[model samples]
Target: MANVSRQPICTLEPKMQNTIVIGVIIRSQNSKIIELARDRFNAGTRAVWNFTLRDSFNDFINATVWGTVEYVNKLFTTFTIGSVVEVINAKVTERKINDPNEVYVPSVTSPFTLTLNQHSSLIQMHNSPNTARYLKFLNMPTKDPGGATNLNHILNNSETLKNEYVDVLVAVTFVSQTREIVTRMGEMTKIREFEVGDDTTDQTVSLTLWESEWIRLADKWEPKQTILFLADVQVVFNEKAKKSILTIVRKTIITENPMLKETEELRFQFQRKPDIRSTSLYAVPNPNSITKQMMIIEITSRLNNASVLPSNDRMQLLVVVRAMVDDMNLDCDDPTLISYRCAKCKRLVSDEKESCMNLECPFGSGIKSPINITSINVLVNLKDDTGYLVGCRLRDAAAEEAFSCSADIMRSEFKIVSSTYTT
Candidate 1:
């Protein structure tokens, strides 16, 4: 848990403020002294200063000053990169350098641009332990980052999209052919575009698979055909397209039909922890019985003791929800969230559309398997004595045991809201 602080989270905005701006100076550039005269009376040099400042929310803004010679130079000296400071009475102005048609968003998480007045005081607490106050807030467990994130979570979250690189699990919805395009330097290159989404989300993310090896993966991909592991992919929210965009780079790993059951289960556990108080909790296995028995634990957080965990094979963690994730998005109102997938193929199937997409599926396409055999993956959070992990997805036999009933009855009886924070 993070300590509470009354100090306001100061995000750089396009407005003048009389109060002080509190954040860390992430970057700084020295002001050049341009001399116009040799005489002592008015021979002083003019200086301009520019820098970036960030707050606890990871919001960043460019702060600059163009003023009388020594005034701007003084600010340049006081506010160095990585220095925490409180600037009293700052001015804000967007950089004219960026094109007006292009969005003003930073290529990174930064917010806007600002300028400090000559009279503004810079209170830099370099030696003090509170200097890195924002670091604590950043590390606070508001949410998990750095792991494979779903397209649904990315589309709904701006913070995750701001990440420089993210791993996403999505299925191919659309795929385009490789085409030649000239770069700004007039060099010819090949590129392809595709779309992908998951059951949790309605929107499809646009994927621009860049050449040279990535374009070859297109041959292996077909519409609604493959589950992909997109690693180290950069997400850019395209305003005009009204969807998140990503480009395949050399670092990106695009794996086809990867087995992600453990990954999916881990994510579900983290997202929504199982409720201990539910009447349906009868099926939950005894914590003591599973103590010596190991379940396959595939995912872990920093809080867990990795030394005891397995490296060669999957480890097991018998955990219950200490806290429940906000599941407003997956409540009774969204019937889709409570739906099911085929019994044999495990592909999603609707009452109206029961036929499986797989032609060679064991049950075969258009077989119309009964709805009772289908399944739905519910998201949850889980914790053991040592620590906790979020987004453990419970489904099938696991779901039945955790909920103390058939998957059908569990959906109708399971509570979306949780009251175990005190637990």
Candidate 2:
């Protein structure tokens, strides 16, 4: 009689352990599949196949098997592009596009597949003669038998269960409204939180920041810049919203800062563009007394004519110019050129001219005749940020004044600092 000793089953490494059971119905299977038959010289011919699983968030590897040629032929006779199947002994392999000899298998492999038989084997393997037996003894259906249904249940009841492992989130368009702060976690430790808006639902979410992330964030962030997190943060749903508006409770954590470098580079590039209009307007308030707020304008073109007026007059003169206007003054001390349509002839004219030059106009012959009239000159007296030119009429005089003033101011304010001495 031969004596036999019980042998220990080979356990998969933690990283390689296949938690997915065979015969499990995958809620979804997305993969690229290819099937080909091999012509073996001495050995029996075998079928070779490949598949790549794909979904919204991830793409994974899957293997296909029909067992033998007869089985494959019968199974794949009506196989379509999206036909689902269970897989077994599915190993992750890397096949070179250019060279077949370069094929290699990944260190890890998953035995789980959509095939029912494979899924059952997986569940049995995990439960039989293992610590997970308790889970099987509880009569809980094996993952292979009911994994998809269980997953769906978990997802549907995700709100009530408060599963911290998974979350869903949508981005807020108004980035300026979001706030950020740092909080202490333990002794000599801290974490960052990004507060985001959900005004439509009248709520907010916090994105937690881990260590090392703070350094990168601190390196380049401003008070009110619009940005997209690009799924780099997780969203924690708020139970309060669920009670009132059927919302989920969650918080955001900085998973990966893919946009940090791009954002910082973009900001620097924007700042380097030399805001000609705003720079010109910097002299408006007494340079000594001007606050940071007083010198900045929302529009980019306003800096074109900042220096034409004397310092005192510059402070008093408020010019709310439109983007379409241009300053044509020869001296640095004139206003900007405003353009308008002639009231009598409907001809395009500069604000400096009172009457339309069109000979076809019936009223062009009279001075102060509404047709022969001089350009209107309304004292602009404008406030730094309080005014906007929405529907106002323009005159030829205003155009000329704007041009002259802008030109003179630009010349005086933008004098190039000379670095060379004349010989």
Candidate 3:
């Protein structure tokens, strides 16, 4: 913390292009950069040590402070994470180029690159305000996961799911014996995966642990230690297995902060259940708020129906599926269920249906009523405090509300052209 002698702090924003900003270093990746780039920047390595600074408005920027053998050795030497400092004449650079092939967002790792050179001034703040006071001054939104979904909910509610990290309360069921694997880059990395889940689901998702000098997350687990895997657990849908699995890459955070009551509850309530939910932390929802209202209703998260299984709630609700859209391509997974119908009668038919085949029906006589998508459905697995429920179907109006698209559009690649294109 730094003492500025009551000097006012300058708030940093994307709107301010080339300006010096003073803020607290709430996040730092100096060590990660050093480790990952150790081989690349081995001797006389000139690399940038990245750090994120938060201003009074809770606005944070990831700044890459360049380090060299002559000028600056490395970042975090004078200030660590949560240290306050005044950066003189910081310039915001363009976003780094990303692979266009990826359907996922560019990643939080890609932000307006903030760089500071040797000529720039770095003044550390010693008597900075406490977190309480800083928060008050920042006026940032309170961090709250009001409607976090469990594994059951995740498997069930597809609309509410986004590309960002998820929160789960999982109990590690099985830890595979450690193994060494080679990455695509020909780097030999030791890796291991384990199954974790809550009591609300059928199976557990996999969480991978890479080999590190100090078994970071693995060591954190005691004979049976439970903690919140706060964010960074990547949700990957295995198309072959037809289920979503979690990937704990290097960015994952495993912590048991007693201050977080939900995490404590998760820690204490964890049982050796085959299918359980893990309490993870996801700070925000997808920012996409676009929705359409009609006879259909959309619901997100879980309905908390753990007391029973194979349930259906007609509660038509509207919630932001939150595409988590950035200025990039949105994370749109293939819809779980597609609806098909007899083209002539508009009656529901299987996707493989060639004709109506009804002996008494006119369309069944000889007409080839190729099944067209009429409506799509989604299955929701929900959990309440009482118990867990699985295989709850969302159809008709509910699917329309949640997916923000008609059943026809959801089932096919064609969009609604116009009123003239109506079937």
Candidate 4:
């Protein structure tokens, strides 16, 4: 076979300075590769290998060799677990941990092109009978006690699953909220909305369970029960709603399918432990200065009387009421307002109020009459640490100013929002 050079993949330099091509060969005696596996069989296996390299501030990284299957067999028969080998297309990654001393680690799973250009070596090593036997053992298929196989397999084999109408069956595994039954009708009673990627996606599609499905889920399902599968959903444009609405028709099945069944057996699979330390905090800055405004208020009461407000008004209100941002409404006819600073109030009453408390301010009041001003709402953008290339919110004037300035100037001028302390 003719040797074809793959497109060069770039990776961050170990010290987080520059991006080097994957196949770029560097000479470094200080760098060492360690095969940190439980057994010899585990060595060179697809797993995270932590190691340190010289000239790098962060010493730890996961080094994954892409062509390991062939390279492992042909390379020295018994190379030391921690031997120095010049990597071709290795990637650098930061180690996430509480310990400050931990170094940035590279992912062992990253694709890489080997430094050695010998294609014959790879083919010979990969074709070895021993390597074949090892792979056979590792990927051995397992059967359930009831003779049930993966439902995904059945779906994959069927043309219906591959149809454009059939978007991927996103197996949403989450902790059930209430006691509910898994009825034959495949309905969930009192079930909450099934969220994809935490209730929203850039793609705009959202999954919605019908009333009957919710009821069946709530009545028959138990809290912390995993393995609930929602399938056969349809995507609607819902242009008026401004978001894609995913509808699962009555024909949709809520089954203890193979994926869900496996998850059910593993009780803790649904639980997610978020990294609180690194998670970004939502904040609004005080207009007077660059300090972030803070408010801490407890819920006084909650109301659920649907008839109290007109259906049209209720629907309009619901559009703006986000679960995380909105306050609970009191039962009284004149509901007590949970106050937060309106941008206008915050700008005007710097001495009187630390943040906006006025409900009449144009920015605070939801009603728009004839103002040409753009709507004021918090906007989020993705970015990394070190302050360089931080995403900016279009509405944030301060962010716009910072973005226009040089990286060094921006870092010194704009204070990164931290949740530990608030103004």
The TM-score values for the models, in the order shown, are 0.28, 0.21, 0.42, 0.22
Q: lDDT: which candidate is best? A: 1
lDDT of 2 by residue, 1-423 (tens): 123222111221222222332221111111213344545643454442223222211222333443445544443343322233223233323333555321321111233322222222211222233433222222211112211112233334545645333322222211111122212221222332343332123233434333332323333333223232321122234453342111211112222222234444434443333211211211121122111233224432344465665675432323333343222223212333223344444455544345556665543433334322223322332324544433233334333364454433432342332112111
Worst 10 residues of 4 by lDDT: 274-283
- On TM-score, the stronger of 1 and 3 is 3
Regions more than 4 Å wrong, model 3: 1-10, 13-45, 54-59, 69-73, 76-89, 92-113, 118-143, 156-180, 190-195, 209-218, 221-224, 239-242, 248-259, 271-423
Question: Model 3: per-residue lDDT, tens digit, 225-338?
Answer: 444443445677766556667665434434233234565465455544222222211111111211323221223223444435445423233233322212221113423466
Candidate 1 CA-lDDT value:
0.51
Separately for all candidates shown, the number of backbone clashes (residues 3 or more apart, or on different chains) is: 25, 57, 36, 29
Q: Residue 74 in model 1: shift from native, Å?
A: 57
Question: What would you estimate as the lDDT of candidate 2?
Answer: 0.30
Q: Model 1 over residues 241-284: C-alpha lDDT tens digits?
A: 56566766433445455545743543343234221111111122
- Give lDDT per model, in order: 0.51, 0.30, 0.47, 0.29
Ranking by lDDT: 1, 3, 2, 4
**Which segments of candidate 4 are over 4 A away from where they belong?**
1-164, 167-192, 196-205, 219-225, 238-245, 257-269, 273-423
Find the candidate with the highest TM-score and give its number.
3
Q: Which scores higher on TM-score, 1 or 2?
A: 1
Report the error of model 3 at residue 124, Å. Answer: 6.0
- Whole-structure CA lDDT of model 4: 0.29
User: What lDDT score goes with residue 301 in model 2?
Assistant: 37
- The C-alpha local distance difference test score for the whole of candidate 3 amounts to 0.47
